[model samples]
Target: MGGEKMLRIVMFPWLAFGHLIPYLHLSNKLAEKGHKITLLLPNKARLQLEPLNFHPSLITFHSITVPPLETLTLPPGTETTADISLNQHGELSISMDRTRPEVESILSTQKPDLVFYDMAHWIPDIASKLGIKSVSYNSVCAISMSHVRPSVLPKAAATSQVALSSSSYVGSVPQWSRNDHNSSVYFGDEITLLERSIISLSSADAIAIRTCREIEGVYCDRVAATFNKPVLVTSHALPDLELQLSPLETRWADWLARFGPRSVIFCCLGSQHVLDAAQLQELALGLEMTGLPFLMAVKPPVGYASLKELLPEGYNDRVSGRGVVHGGWVQQQQILAHPSLGCFVTHCGSSSMWEGLVSETQLVLLPQLPDQTLNAKLMADELKVGVKVERQQNGWVSKQGLCEAINRVMDEDSDISHVVRKNHAKYTSMLISPDFITGYIDNFIKDLQALIS
Candidate 1:
């Protein structure tokens, strides 16, 4: 960029939108600096991301069709975790591995200066053979990336697991992570997630995590040491507050406008992590118990036709004016940015975490998946920017727990509320400061150039 060469970078993220979206945002940032970016993703995702592409002149979308899987039976057009059940994401991981040939061919012909990837662990090996640099770009935080040092796990067929029981699981893994990693939710008949992650981290030339020193400096340093690679943090690449929020449905804007500023709770768990009917009822009752207005966006729980079907008996009738639990996706960024959004009950995905941090809303976490569990810990435990809903030993959240967490943050007089409020504001101010994100991106681009130089 400084009269030096611009790079042609390929972005091949895991099939899930959580992974795909961040990679695309990184691509946009790189492209803005005049680097040519070719993003390889499923056709459907390509279509969905087209509108969000800020640098169409320099960034191109190349769709990769998922090859057939022998061990898994998926309905037609399941390309991402959003398309399948939470536990079935291992199937998606297997499909990503199966695309190695297609990706290799693209790399061979394109011969890009560098490629950024995660989950597709084989990319670094193939890129090295082609004399190309590969950066294992983890869109999640460094904590999950550094959880294992890559040498510990071995790949096994997606058919039957290689058996990592609690007895066999090695050191420092919290009970939540251990339970999660051992569950079918983390792995499938293909290679396990631990293997996919560490293998990629070990082989890649550089490791970039979508985090910052403010939130996860120690974890980032640990990751660099663990992999012996230049581990760089992206400094919150999905800077939604800086970008324009599109008007999704006028009704949401209209409905939200009626509430006083910072008075309504905006609840939207991520695309995955669908609650059961029982849990959905608990969430509904919990928000209702807070006696605050809310807008909750979620799908019907398992076996229920709609969100309406899972409501507690006469639940809607009782909380009719105060709560609205609509089914399906909403423009979460816009919803979070709303003037009326007082509290955000989130799944603590990387995107949601960044968004909540940058916003003025109070953070109340209800994390479901394993990575999300760690993310919740970062905010609720380490950073003390939010309060987490206490869970039963079996990991099910109750209505009372959810209600208490929301009220704790929303309560003006409570000490815990005062702490999270003060801390959340303090960090948010640092994140939005001038040159905060730009400094990281400009320095990161130089680091990338250094790799190819």
Candidate 2:
């Protein structure tokens, strides 16, 4: 940053924690590069960012009170999708759309050099009115982005009215067909998300994707061609999760230490996507059948009062010493990085994928939604760093299926396991290498400078 002009950037990400965290990570990187970041978030969602330990001087938190949940006919304290049930996620997206005025007001006062927005479809127009440049900072991977972009799809599918499901579009890549949930509530209605994404991308001065050329160069290229806009790859801004262990983290760490190296399965389904009782039962039984040490963190599905109510009878007693099932929040990055973590059973979210890649742990993918399904495909089919667990035609995982997939990835002799471990090691070395990350950040800042100039 020597003799460089310091920039003032306004960042407004979607209301979800998953989206917010990545935006904060990017803000941190920009701040480190001598830029000032004004992060606009809902009051409650702003609380989620406080723990991330951002640079106090360069990054400022500006709270915008979201329209009350009660007024929106949504649940109280529902600032993010993580605070509500899956079915109610659509309301959260719609509710955020109502924050346009608040955002405009912030822009009017901040007079920032640029605005980096995610999923806020109306941002570009507002920024343009203020003569401020805007960039659509996508936190998702390039594969998912390209697959969803209409111009990248086949002519027939692209012209069709039906929204292409993630499995149908991405799984159909090459010669594959897999059933997946038709849509995701996380981004609201499928058609709406597509329209919004297209609008936002169309309006932005440039597109910033949280991916690297090594992983999805072709997709990134396709994105640039499709939109006819400059595409900037930020690589994956991996968050620093090496904070001192809390009491709960210490307990889990101590428990994992008892296992032999690379022998424990770490299962976390992220903040969203709770499991129903039947799915929970099958998953519990599956983990029990593995006969391997495991730690699972679950959020009980809708209508279930607690995790205990969702567990199968005597399930806890049966797997007493072999497994631990804790409900609610868990320090996921700490668990993934633990020496005993043999495999990661994940929902295949982009952030989780980056963490898993950095951890060098084999991935056991259990994708619960559309974007996750696409992520699973890229990890298993393209990257070859993970194994997607087999699900029934109706898209449900059984006890045996889960056990077999977990065992397959854990087994050293199996070809899938071997390839996954090999690829994981290769990618991990590249990701953690100092040169790779530094070069990526340098290029990203160069792109931002060009945009402003």
Candidate 3:
């Protein structure tokens, strides 16, 4: 073991924690194999992710200061997607791209064996210049990568943005590419989101997807065909089941303790999935109609200054005992693990999708983004593990549709409920098995080594 070679790897993930956390999970596994890792992220995120660093000595966090936005300066510490709304994402992208010099400085000094990254497509150029191989790690599912090419929304989405109405369309696919980018005032002739991904994947030395054949073999094959590169699977880079659980907040603990086993609904739309005021109230009313105790955590919707102001009139008084609606982020892992939680309504982001599959709760998916839409289809249509809320032609998900999806999974007497429950349980048991994870990760390490060899 001592005589064998050790790899030096650098990790450069996207700005979102959803992306960073999974990259870090991959780092933990690589470090366990005696590999050295340098994790590059925004300066502000370093302290928040410090606790998850299992091997402080082998894996180091290197902060990269994002450049200031040319037109609009963000608050002093706005360093990531979580720091801004969805439409303002383009500004952040400009800042990230401007960090090329800093990243180049870091990469040249380190000269690691491999560079792993997702966004910031120009990484391959830097890696080639430094004589280091680069790998484009897929944080989203292969289905999304294959079928849905993420594109930049109109620049109007930035300034002219308003509350999403019942008639508003957030449908992922055709609409993204359907629009003409010929006349846009965005980062002023900057690359589109889809273009960035394409450039990154096409230019990278290797592709490492955080997925397994069992769940997405066909889609993975499609991705490989599209990119004409071998796609390595890291077994979904699922969070380590053995890691110690973070303590839940006492207020949340005490309130959740009041409910019976598997009797509460937990709905979280991730940190960045914003809904409008009416949408939020409708979702709350849907849960209320379920006549079940619930916990909902969400980001502030457009046009809402605060959660208190965003709520429907009589919302607090009406759903007093049954609902706990929070406006900001929450420890979803802790909440999902609670005994009283039976159902999870999610936005079907990659992390939440994996978490819901592994947890004991049945799923109700309301996917908003493109990647999320495909992920929801995979879970509900392909895996039969959950039910997706029905959307109208205008891409609106009504309160009734949401309530029905939840009831389909939560009603013990319903045959549909039993069917999905059995499938979800069966997959959950297999996915979490220690041997299953080890086999995939072991193969993944060999593949990683192969790339360098």
Q: Each candidate: what lDDT?
A: 0.80, 0.79, 0.79
Scored by Cα lDDT, where does model 3 land?
0.79
lDDT of 3 by residue, 1-453 (tens): 245568899988988899999998888877777889999998778988887788889999999998776568565567998888876676777788778788889999999989999887778878887888889998888888886332333333322212111112232224332122332323212555555566677777778888889999999898777666778998765656547446878889899999999999999998766887778888888998898999888877877777888777888898898898888778787788888999999999998988898899989999877678889989988999999999988777778988999998999899989889999999989888878877887787777778888
Q: lDDT tens string, model 2, 70-139?
A: 6455777667777777666667777787787888999999899999997786787788878898999999
Compute the lDDT of residue 231 as modeled in candidate 1. Answer: 84
TM-scores of the candidates are: 0.92, 0.90, 0.90
Write one digit per residue (lDDT tens) for candidate 1, span 386-450: 99999999878887898899999999899999999999999989887748888888889888889
Q: If the candidates were sorted by their TM-score against the true structure, best first, what order would they fall in? A: 1, 3, 2
Distance from true position, residue 225, model 2, in Å? 0.9
Instruction: Name the runs in model 2 displaced over 4 angstroms.
Output: 69-72, 150-191, 241-248
Error of 3 at 232 (Å): 0.8
Candidate 1 least-lDDT 10 residues: 157-166
Which regions of candidate 1 are displaced past 4 Å? 154-190, 240-242
